[model samples]
Target: MRHIDCQKRISLLVDGSLDGPAVREALDHLTECPDCARAYEKMVSLNNALTNVKPSLADSSLASKVKVRISGESNSAGYAWNFSLLKQVPIWALIAILAVGVGDMAGKTLTETLNMHDTSHNLENLIQDNGESLTDVLIDFGQSENGR
Candidate 1:
């Protein structure tokens, strides 16, 4: 038998459920295969430990109750299924959101800067001109009231 076949039958061997021929074959394989020997020893220890455990409760077999409890636990609580896809959300989505927010903030900052620049230019021109041409005023005012 293959290692896998021997492995599958190992549970039966550990539980003492195997027939005489199977027992002989398993022992023969154990003599040759160190990996199977280790596995067999582990299973033997687990079985011994399980056999030694005592039940505190009255009127119930410990092994059967433990089996039922394990079966229920496996059936009811194991293998949680989720359709929410929460784990599927990409880091790129967060990065894109961050990029869009930063771009919007940058655009606002640039627009405000441009508006300030335009306002500053207009104010400087107003200050320099003083609202009237100096030469026109000078020519008119320089002429005397007697039309000189």
Candidate 2:
């Protein structure tokens, strides 16, 4: 077997999950390859160390507290988060309005500045296309309004 193949089998070997033939092949490879042997030794030592570890919890009520929080039985801490978010709503709204207003003004100013030289010629072209100038259209609007 290849060195990498033997290394891959090290975990299953440590867990004692490899069958007879595969175990023999992997052990043969490990004995022939120093790298595979070192990998196997490291995995075995890590497994042993983890197996011997004991969980230490200083606060016994910590689990019960977590359960209460998850069940929503105790909500004193939850309200502070909700109330703080609610209090910031108006400030956020004002900031959004200010952003929109500034954007609109900047857009208008940029367009007007960029199109300054073309404005009069563009208006005349538009006015002439439909047989109506600005003054003629305004007069027509006035006549209609008077009729209304």
**Per-residue accuracy of model 1 over 23-48 as CA lDDT, tens digit each:** 99888988999999999999899888
lDDT of every predicted structure (CA atoms): 0.78, 0.81
Residue 95 Cα positional deviation in candidate 2, in Å, after optimal superposition: 45
- What are the models' TM-scores? 0.37, 0.40
C-alpha lDDT (0 to 100) for residue 15 of candidate 2: 95
Error of 1 at 45 (Å): 0.4
Per-residue alpha-carbon lDDT of candidate 2 for residues 1-148, written as tens digits (9 for 90 to 100): 5656667788899999999998898888788888878999999999999999978898879999889777784476578788888788888797998898788667467667566687778887744556678788888868988999
User: Clash pairs of candidate 1?
Assistant: none
Off by over 4 Å in 1: 58-148
